[model samples]
Target: MNKSRIFRTLLGIAIVSAVPTLAHAQKANWQNLDLKSDSTFGISTEKAYKELLKGKKSVKVIVAVNDGGVEATHEDLKRIMWVNTKEKPGNGKDDDKNGYIDDINGWNFIGGPKESVNFETLELTRLVRRDQARFANTTDANVAEKDKKDFEAFKAERAELEQKLAEAKENLAGITGFKTALDAVVQKIGKENPTAEDFKNFKPSTAIEGRIQGILIQQLEKGSFKDFYEDQIKEGLDYYTRQAEYNLNLDYDPRSIVGDDPNNDKERFYGNNDVAGPDAMHGTHVAGIIAADRTNKIGILGVADNVAIMGVRCTPNGDERDKDVANAIRYAVDNGAKVINMSFGKAYSWNKAVVNEAMKYAASKDVLIVQAAGNENKNIDVENNFPNHKDLDEKTIASWITVGASGPKDDETLKASFSNYGKNQVDVFAPGVQIYSTVPGSKYKSLDGTSMASPVVAGLAGLIRSYYPKLTAAQVKEIIVKSVTKVNHNVEYAKGEGPDAEKVSVPFSDLCISGGIVNAYNALKLAATYSGKSVAK
Candidate 1:
């Protein structure tokens, strides 16, 4: 067989293996529909808006979406964006004197006047780099007793970076080779966009060609060959390449562009005014889930109609810095954001103290913070995910609620396979699997992750605060946790890693603190009762 034909066969096998298996159940827009009436696993926001909130007076609530960035000009999001009235738009001045210049919408902590930091080194990599002098040459004899833990951490992180770098290089090579082979096939076929029929009709005399044909036919059943190879494969190759070049590169320093002391948490006011930075897909999806325009009839309705989304861009494609996260929290709190949605988390936290202090500040200001419980599929009670509600001494933050993703089905796979669960760490479950929300440029997509789940809870908090203005952030957190729809049935818990990992039967209630999924109607009812207010029946 020819070398090109063999490569094509290998490429076909690689592509087929990479494709995710389709779920047996049909896809449903269950996240937006009423759970009670529609028999879907939703928060019942539709029912709440239709039945309970008919004549209720709503107060405008500002929600801070502290993620990558947000599309302030998005058709469904523009009208509902929180504008800094005190600051002058288009004028190069810190009119509000809040330190950020021209921050008419919000602020971007990961960008500067001329540049934006999209991909960055992980926290672990940074930590290893920072402590290189102290731990690099020190052995057990020379290492100080107090520095023992730091030394151990440094060693572990170094090993992790080395392993990750090797893996990323391997992945990049494989993806690049596959793409080249795919391009060769396309050229040989003499089609810019080859279809399944074309591949099927083409007579393959060689064994390798026959194998390639079979693989293409299999993939075409799921999606078009052009889409699979051009879009998905290209994206994978780019991601792996970036991971090898930036994320695992110990010498890489993308933070210098921001020009802020990352170690100094007190240096809070140093980021640019471009809230919607280079990438806003993640943040826009999160913001739309919380407060998309409801009356526009253009996109899907948001969880809270009377909300003004404030974009405080901090998170990047890689893990967010603790200093930026802390500053983002303070900015949101100072700018009158009652609810802060953090749809991001990382395994390691280099400066947990600073982030905790910021969380305390938000708590003091009575601002509710909803964080994703992470998508690692691990029990977070044992393993840690950063920016959690718990303090170093194990005291929980009153204003914080960590959310896990829940699927549409109420059966064995009730909890999302990728969702991180914990009876202690994770507060509640929410609709996150295949959640349809607005992305960048006014487009809508169904993305899965606990990142999506956190915003669902954040939107609920926004809704509760909007109707019941008297309730404190702590009270809102309590209402959300206390009003979830309890699910006592057993669920198929993820036993290992990946989609095809073995699943073990575990009770759904054991997955989270609330032992239930968040319900908007129940939360609203609880809010009304707690505040001694009447709702429209």
Candidate 2:
């Protein structure tokens, strides 16, 4: 691909097949399986729960999920929702006086008194808008020496944003046309939801009909045709529409509802108490992966049982603001959150200094920040992902762990194709592809991204903190990083650009800092050794 096309593709989320196999067998939740007995790619949570935590006393550990939003009232999450005991519900007052009013569940920074901002511009777009007027005609002679660097950065971002906007418009037009034709074929078939057998048995009367039939058949061979049409395509259309209308629009400003100074770092506490904002699918899934009800028997079991999930709504559907992220971290830390799981990221940050200060504050309060290594399928060492652990001076925070995604099969294709990796930046790898977790409306579904992998590690961190209450945040991070199950072999990884991409053999260990996948059982053993606790023989 060319430079423009590469930038366009990277702007969107990377979607990869979770299960690369062709067989239509009932899939197992291999992410939670015990590798010792199941011989599958998993974190071994079952083994740790049955063997090590059988007779152990549990302690309540609070894990703050800082994402778009979380359905705290979901069937699997209601009982485990972190309640603010100090503050009374619906009293119209700050009962606890912790800089928030009526934070019974948590606080939402992206919403106002009555409305929530669902979509916002990307960081790059925001930067372009802010500096375009000042740097539009900047020259070496005209621009001040101090402002020359910022002017150059603004020019680069504006160029990239313009290219991405053009590509999004073109892609949206193509998909819209395709959807219209597919709807006509569906109408001709006289079935709103057609099965694979129906498509196979239908007699094509024209070349377009035959071509549509072939496409549907090929898609059905991978998974459900219904899901491919209703969920994937529909969501893709919405994503592209949003990208064109909101993400790339320089005139769009969703921060007016919050009614705060976006550039001010000292201003804090200016949002409403609606923690579970308009969309809660992503945050709800992350929360379920960490602490869904295990004994309810309604949905799948979460990794930890003694976890109180504190929902801090900071991220919107688009790129999250740096000011909100900084406040969210401080809010979680001040509200007794031991582990904060941040499942959202972007390519650029307008105010990284404030975020770094918040991270420093979290570390000072003994809070560990677990972040997702982005799903760009590119090394993060060369590319930039915002809200990271690295400070401006290139020093990393001690209580942070950056997680990458891993796949099911433990062979040459062990690493997830869509997962972003860096030996120095990403701390560990976990199961992220096709993770079945809780969604909105008390439902469960499978989603893929490094966003899913971050919570798996966060849940394990919560588990260790619950069992070993004396372990510091830094110690917990160290134990998780050091206890990874090393995969020392060459794997066929997807390389090169789009369409021309090919599988190339590379050592899996070089992808991440731990050089292995995370194992809950191994983490538990290491925790026991660190805390001097005896394990079951």
Best TM-score among the predictions, by candidate number: 2
Candidate 2 clashes between residue pairs 3 or more apart in a chain or in different chains: none
Q: Tell me the TM-score of each prediction against the true structure.
A: 0.91, 0.93
Best by lDDT: 2
Give residue 423's lDDT in candidate 1 (0 to 100).
Answer: 89
What would you estimate as the lDDT of candidate 2? Answer: 0.82
lDDT of 1 by residue, 1-537 (tens): 000000112442222123322232324346756655787888898898888999889999999999999999999999999999998888899888888889988999998758888888877778778878667689878888889997888888788888978877877787786676566666778888788888888777666566667777777776667556743676576677667888778888888888888777788778788888888888998898898898898887888989999999998877899989989999999999999999888888888999888888888888989999887788988887897766633223668899999888788878987788998989999988777788887888766788888888999999999999999888898899989999978998768754467869988888998999999999998888886532222
- Positional deviation of residue 444's Cα in model 2 after best superposition, in angstroms: 0.5
- Listed per candidate, the RMSD to the true structure in angstroms reads 5.4, 4.2
In terms of lDDT, the poorest run of 10 residues in model 2 is: 1-10
Q: How many clashes (backbone atoms < 3 Å, residues ≥3 apart in a chain or on different chains) does model 2 have?
A: 0
Q: Write down the worst ten-residue block by lDDT for model 1.
A: 1-10
Clashes of 1: 0
